[model samples]
Target: MQVLPKGVRHIPGFLDRTRQEQLVEAIRLVVAEAPLFVPEMPKTGKPMSVRMTNCGSLGWVTDRDRGYRYQAQHPVTGHPWPAMPDVLLEIWNAVSASNKTPEACLVNFYSEEARMGLHQDRDERDLETAVVSISLGDSCLFRVGGNTRGGQTMSFRLESGDVVVLGGEGRLAFHGVDRIYPNTSTLLKHGGRVNLTLRRVNP
Candidate 1:
């Protein structure tokens, strides 16, 4: 495991595949209640290509007409969002040194061709809080740039069971997955990479 100059952590094989699968199933159950749906972009309310869903106090939503905001219930089910599973919480507390408690888990699924452009995660209420991300399935080229953006960016080839902690100064840094490399792992059920971003929302 190594810490990037930007302060992002790259812990290799942090979660074993078996534990990773269990965590995935637990997260899937929450998603099953809500399922993955594309969020609409704020202001214009355009739908984002990346399907997103959450488990916790609020779920992230976006539509060309609505935009980014956390809602107490699922837009589709009208049911209160589910809690973040135990396995996820264990992992979060373990790595974050028990200093942070996560209330929202945003699961992002990427196919071989799917990719996220450079962006900063500023939707949460507190900048002091940390964002703990777990990666599974195929490997991906994850990139982290300077907080102000438009500078030399560092990238990592993240694979299954990798845990990355984004916090401190890097908490507000611009970052995203460049592209997923296919056939990187046979352990993943189907294909693609699944990123579980666990965050503490309440300030």
Candidate 2:
């Protein structure tokens, strides 16, 4: 077992091939309805490298003007996000210690060149709830640091079907994808990585 920072648990190949394919198909349905849209950084309005969409009742969204917040509808389509798939809820129930079910599942589609800067997931009203992340498609180097920026950090490779749980003291840790390795996996049809982050938006 790889030793990660406190409260950070990395479960490699947590999902079998069959389950991974099922998740991919489920996300495909989600994208067909919600569609992925580019997210922008607050103030600067810098566009994020990856395209994003969401599932579940609440969806995470960001724009230069309003910043990061959870909304009931998509930014461009103005339609309510599709409901959270039952498979995701089962994963949360099996892993997340909290009794509350996730209200939002942020779907991030990262191309070969897409990379995310290290940041904390603090938009949620309750920080006590855990953040459950499921990795599918290509592999990427995931970087994780302590609660504060500039703190000690570590990098590890996350492949398809990997599951990571950020809970307890690690709930607010800073983490991000350094870069995506193209053709690393055959999960996604066209080749890319899909990251599904499940979180409790409200207290």
Candidate 3:
């Protein structure tokens, strides 16, 4: 009952090695209730080496004068964004063929010298729902492209409970994350790499 290949998916052990250690203890309680830093790239505030954080109910951020945006709190601790762990909304309503229940998750942390260039996530407010991603710990290099820029490119390695699904028009296609292979997954305990992106943010 694992899936991932409608254009790109691997689903290696699609969650259930005891729920993959309960999704790594629910992402370490959402990084201890939103507590990871290293953001400041807005208009040259300069300081992004991938270390951001978030939970549920909205929490994606950026600063280089705003390139990406999502907020409900926590722009440096306004205190409010952290609660999407009912096992990640039951794995986003069971892989969401179209049951969508994601109100923003965007918790990305990577560190074997972090890397996430080439981007494209169109400020989610409407893209026909579905951008569900959830690859935890090590094994990177997940590049995807289309919607015109050379029109075709692909890469994969995803691993660790891999579950990626883009929507309508490939949910605006164009993807990122192309690095980090160091110490490739010993099953988390501090080694870096966590990407939980569940979208649909309209407030």
Candidate 4:
């Protein structure tokens, strides 16, 4: 059996098909308000493979100028991010061990060819709170490593309705997506992947 790092909880099929559909619909409404925009790498300004948006009081955004940070307004639209969906809030309450509610839900849409580089979630002030991640649509190869760079790593397939929580020692672990499996799920009409990442930005 493969062993994940400490404090990393992988709950497979945490969301049922019905709940997944409902969450997708909620995200659609969020997209309608915030609209997905391609994120850029800090300094280099290279566009990331995934298109991203957010809901909740704060949204995670990165650009050539400001880098990764949470803000109240969309970078392009200049409007506050849509409120966090009830389903997402419920999920966070169910999985997250922290008492504080998540203040940001970063929504990332990944195409079949999209991939994410290994990185840590360290922008938020509340590092003690667990990061709740929900996977939808197609499955993907998820890679995770230790807190330090170039450490031992493990890769696993994450399918639709799967939930991953990173807290405790694993909160600062390096993780990313390797590749997305196309047509693996029929949840999204266009055949891609959607990742909802919930985080607490403040103490």
Candidate 5:
């Protein structure tokens, strides 16, 4: 078994098949209210491979002009983000190990060819709060490294229903998705992966 960094907890099969299906339905409602939009890299305006949206009080967004930041309204819809689902709140309460509630649930959908570069989630005001990531649908090669860029890294498969928590020393870890394994699972009707990241944006 590969050992993860300090404070980085990986729980395999955290959610059962039924729960995963329920969460997918909940996310469908969220996407209906706040459609998934393409996120762009700062300055270069390069589009990311994943399509994203969010729920909760604040949503994370990035663009060539504004860069990475949290906002209350969707960039495309210009409406307040939908409320965080109770199912997500229950999961956070169960595994977050924090007293405070999460204020943003960033939803990312990865196609078979989608890939994410190693990056840190540092735009939020509260760095101490842990980031909870829940995976559904297909599995993917998830990579993680130390806090510093260009450091040694490790890779592992994050299958559907797996959960990862980045807190304490590992909260600022550099992590990303290497690639998606096509037709890995049947959880999603279309055979893509959906990653839900729960975070506390403010202190």
Candidate 6:
């Protein structure tokens, strides 16, 4: 088994092609309902490279005025986020090791030139709950490091159908996408990467 940071698990190709296709379709429906919107950096108001949307009861969002927060309505439309897909709930149940279902599913779309800065998912009320992420479409370079900043980090490629779980000691670790490799997979017709992160927002 490939070793990683404590409590961090990477399951490569966890979903088969058929499942990936089904996930893609499910995401399509979610996008149609919620729509992707650009997220801005806290205070700075700098727009993130990737576009984002969400499903489930709460959605993580950031902007110059509000900073990072979870809300029940879409930033753009003011409508509640779409329901969490059953496939995602099943994945979380199988791997999260927690009885509570995730209340937020952040959907991030990265173009060929997009990347994310190293950051921790720390806005949730409960740190005990694990964060589950699923990758689809093109591959990307994922970077992860210790809980503290400027610590030794590692980079690895995350391909389509891969699943990553951040739990226990690794739950607060810093991680992000360095870059996307276009055309690495034929999963998305337009050639981009979609990342789904399921998180429990409240205690």
Model 3, position 146, has a per-residue lDDT of: 66
User: What is candidate 3's lDDT per residue for 108-188, written digit by digit as tens?
Assistant: 888888887766678877777767888887888887876555666677778677888776667767778888787888778
lDDT per residue for candidate 4 within 114-142, as digits (tens), equals: 99999999999999999999999999999
lDDT of 2 by residue, 1-203 (tens): 55688999999999999999999999999999999999999999999999999999999999999999999999999999999999999999989998998999999999999999999999999899999999999999999988999898999999999999999989999999998989999888899999999999889
Two-way lDDT contest, 1 vs 2, winner: 2
The count of backbone overlaps in candidate 1 is 9
lDDT of 5 by residue, 1-203 (tens): 77898888999999999999999999999999999999999999999999999999999999999999999999999999999999999999999899999999999999999999999999999999999999999999999999999888999999999999999999999999999998999999999999999999999
* TM-score between model 3 and native: 0.30
- How far residue 201's Cα lies from its native spot in candidate 6, in Å, is 0.6
The C-alpha stretches of model 1 lying farther than 4 A from their native spots are 1-3
lDDT of candidate 1 over 1-203, digit per residue (tens): 54474667778999887898798788678878878877766677665556777887776666666666677888777888888788988989887654767878888888888888898888888667878889988999999877877877878899899998887777887889888999898766788788988887778
Which parts of model 4 are misplaced by more than 4 Å? Answer: none
**lDDT value, residue 182 of candidate 3:** 70
TM-score of each: 0.92, 0.98, 0.30, 0.99, 0.99, 0.98
Candidate 6 minimal-lDDT segment of 10 residues: 1-10
lDDT against the true structure, per candidate, is 0.81, 0.96, 0.76, 0.97, 0.96, 0.95
> Which regions of candidate 6 are displaced past 4 Å?
1-3
* Comparison by TM-score, 2 against 4, better one: 4
- How far residue 153's Cα lies from its native spot in candidate 1, in Å, is 0.6
